[model samples]
Target: MVTIIKGKDRAEYPEFFTQLFKLRYKVFVEGRGWSLPTKHGLEIDQYDDDEAIYFLDVNEHGIIEGTVRITPTVQSSLTADYFSHLIENGQSPRSSRVYEATRYIVRPSQKSRDLNRAAKSRLLAALTQWCLENDVESIQTVIDSNTLPTFLELNPKVLPMGLSYPYGGGRNTHGGGDCMAIRWPISQEILECVRLYGDLSLLHAVDAISSENIGEMIH
Candidate 1:
């Protein structure tokens, strides 16, 4: 199930971050080769301040499967602070209605590649649910070509905001290839799209409920 952990409540769950940050270290630091500020096998960045909220999809055992980070544009965001040049004419998302989504990662423990990918779909669905719950108007993020396909699938007409540029080591793209900043309009349609494409059985507890036993929520 997806667990909602806002910045304020983060301190309440130390073990959660321990597992989640280790996953981030594996995915972003070791795997993707992003030069993030990582130490003690924890991928912690400045953007992980109180302004950020984390959506984590964990198994019934509390093991993190995948996670996403949403930073309010009204405060500091990945786009506004660092990747502004990727925005058209430097007009990054800065209003409260818009949010910046980042740090999407799926744990590599899944031996089945197909199951791992399907779990990522569930993570996307969870992120969409968060946007819907928070009344978010638009969601912006920086991603490389590797993730463009999934975003395209989630938003049928998804497109880049401006020309692609190099960032702190793009993911899965060749030689840290061009990373694009994208914005998607938030609406019920997004939730519908996720429902249409995500693993429906994993939809339980992505938004309102964060049951310790996801199996219980499924039925």
Candidate 2:
């Protein structure tokens, strides 16, 4: 199942955070060779602040198998702060109803392609559910060419914000590929499509936590 962890409640789950960061280190640093700030084998950045929310797909053993980060665009976000140039006409989304998603990673522990794809679909469904509940209208993110097709398959409403640029490779340490910024509109119809494509049930796919019931889960 997927677990929702808001930044304010991060202190309650230190071990989970530890594993999450290490997983990110393994994926982005060791695997993708991204030149990100690191300390003691943890991959972290300025965007991991109180305004950020994390979605974790944990296994039965409590290990984080897949994860993603969401930050409100009204505050600092990757798209607005860093990739504004990628947006066509230089109009970056900045509003409470819009958010930026980043740091999507899935553990490579399992070699089965089907398992990995299922995990990714689960995360996408969970994100769609949360956005619908919270009134988030859209998601802005930078993704490589390899991932764009998958996004388009899930939701035809996905729109590219600007032209793709060659990232990573050579001197660039952010992994190799042509990456572009895109915006995805959120709606009940979109959520249904995701749930159907992922074969996920709303009752079992996500366990969305909030500040009100966070203590109950912790205890």
Candidate 3:
């Protein structure tokens, strides 16, 4: 199951966020060796403010398997602040309809290549659905160059903002190879392709999040 946590509703789900922070710490800090702010073993940054919306992929046992954070570019964007040079012609997209997705991670325990691929696909599908509903026209993100092919496979519409550059620990970096920024246009066709790649039924992907369902889960 997927849970959509709006910045305003974060107080209502303390445990979820706790686990999410730990998971992030495990993946990015400890695993990837990325230097980031840490408090009580939780990895967090300024971008985790109330303006961010989170998509968490949880299992039947309520364990978070994967997660992604999306923040509006008009507000505060990692790309605009840190990676603006990566943008094509150095034009970072800043608009209400444009969002930057960061901290996308899946638990490393799912070591099987196929399992990891499926888990990432599901998370992407859920994100695409939410973006479609929220009228998000484009999503900007920095990703490892090695994974660019996978993104293209899921949605051929991905546009590279700039060339990949060596980052964080060189070739053996946790994210893999060089990193680059890319933008994905949100549309029905893109969503459909994601759904098909993940083999997710329309109901499973589109109806994953709703007020009623969230209320039930929270209680």
- Highest-scoring model, lDDT: 3
lDDT of 3 by residue, 119-144 (tens): 87788889998999999999999998
Quick one: how many clashes does candidate 1 have?
0
The lDDT values for all models are 0.77, 0.83, 0.85
Report clash pairs, candidate 3.
none
RMSD of 2: 11.8
Candidate 3 deviant stretches above 4 angstroms: 108-111, 172-177, 200-219
Per-residue C-alpha lDDT of model 2 across residues 158-207, encoded as one tens digit per residue: 99989887776632444677788998899999887776655534423443
- Expressed as tens digits, the lDDT of each residue in 1-219 for candidate 1 is 788899878889999988888888888788877778988899999888887899888887778888889898888687777878887855656987888888887773565655765777678777777888888888888888567887786678565888887665554453376788988777778777766655545444343456565668665
Query: Model 1 clash pairs?
Result: none
| Model 2 / residue 170 / CA error / Å | 6.8
TM-score of 3: 0.85
- Ranked by lDDT, the better of candidates 2 and 3 is 3
lDDT at position 180, candidate 2: 86
